[model samples]
Target: MDLDHTGVSADELRRLLRELSGDLLSRRRFVRTYVEMWPTRLSRLVAAIDDDDLDETKVVLLSIRSSSVMLGVTGLAHLATQGLHALERHDLIECRHVRDLLAESGDRACERLLELEATESMLGR
Candidate 1:
């Protein structure tokens, strides 16, 4: 059999998200759930794009875009917006450009997420 993941299929991702989010609404909803995990998700997406896994990158990028807006993160939305265009239409080389745009931002996002998670723990939220 030729096993393949053409990209992070929304269905498979949705199943995983339900496990994490404790809800089962739709694939879009699953993606939106990552709004709270944007830092981790964006880092993974950028890495996936660098590895030339556009599909996986797309899923994470999609999550970031949707989640960013939903979570009131407009400044970070550009990263996902650029990633989406690259994933949907650009070739690997061009896609790398989009990934490059996000590289530093992803790093910052990770740091922010870490700090917030720690604060949340301290506050018992």
Candidate 2:
């Protein structure tokens, strides 16, 4: 499968579908859940950062990075990884910058995933 310009990897999504025994319904459900939780995740990440809670910030960044990697959200994953590195260096400024980037990229990624899902369903993929 070709990679999407939306920063989502169609190949990885297909792999996930294959892991679910090619069950489209399951894939759709998972995607929906992921999309729905995105805002909450972002909110939690912001809260953690604003509170200067390093541990919480680390947990949130790791969660975002791991989940994004699995979901083929490469841009968001990269930003999350950057946030983690910034956190490790105790660079709040860099961490804040990455957090902003994540907010933008993550939203775009989720929107693209939804669009992809709709297109796939319409095309009977």
Candidate 3:
């Protein structure tokens, strides 16, 4: 899939995994782990935002952004980065916008990850 249309650099993800791990099984396992934790992370992010906790929000956003970069989840990373910038500027409204975008993108990414899991299973991976 050309995920670039959705602003995701799939090639970067593939390259990073190949460079860092060079093992398909390990990479797949990481993907599964990431998919499993994604929702909980999102919920925590929302809670931090709702509580107006800038410190917590920065921590969570940085974690998510760094992990997303490793996973080649560029859209999520971008959203988190935007949120961080908004937080730095004390723009709560922009932070909310970024949060919404992150949620929407994360949901779609989750669906795609599930599909990838199914395909991998079918391929005996």
Per lDDT, the best of the predicted structures is 2
The local distance difference test score of each candidate is 0.54, 0.82, 0.75
Model 2 lDDT, residue 96, Cα:
87
Q: In candidate 3, what are the lDDT values of residues 1-125, reduced to their tens digit? A: 52321244556546755675556667677777878888988888899989999998899899888978787677788788889999999998898887877777887776665565456445544
Models 1 onward score TM values of 0.50, 0.88, 0.81
Residue-by-residue lDDT tens digits, candidate 2, 8-119? 7777777787788878898889788888989988899999999999999999999888877777777788788889999999999998888877776777799998888777
- Per-candidate clashes, comma-separated: 0, 0, 0
TM-score of 1: 0.50
lDDT of 1 by residue, 58-84 (tens): 787777667554433444566567667
Question: Which candidate achieves the best TM-score against the true structure?
Answer: 2
* Pairs of colliding residues, candidate 3: none
Candidate 1: regions farther than 4 A off: 1-36, 107-125
User: Would you give me the overall lDDT of model 2?
Assistant: 0.82
Whole-model lDDT, candidate 3?
0.75
Higher-lDDT candidate of 1 and 2: 2
Clashing pairs in 1: none
Between candidates 2 and 3, the one scoring higher on TM-score is: 2
Residue 100 lDDT in candidate 3: 76
- Candidate 2 off by > 4 Å: 1-6, 123-125
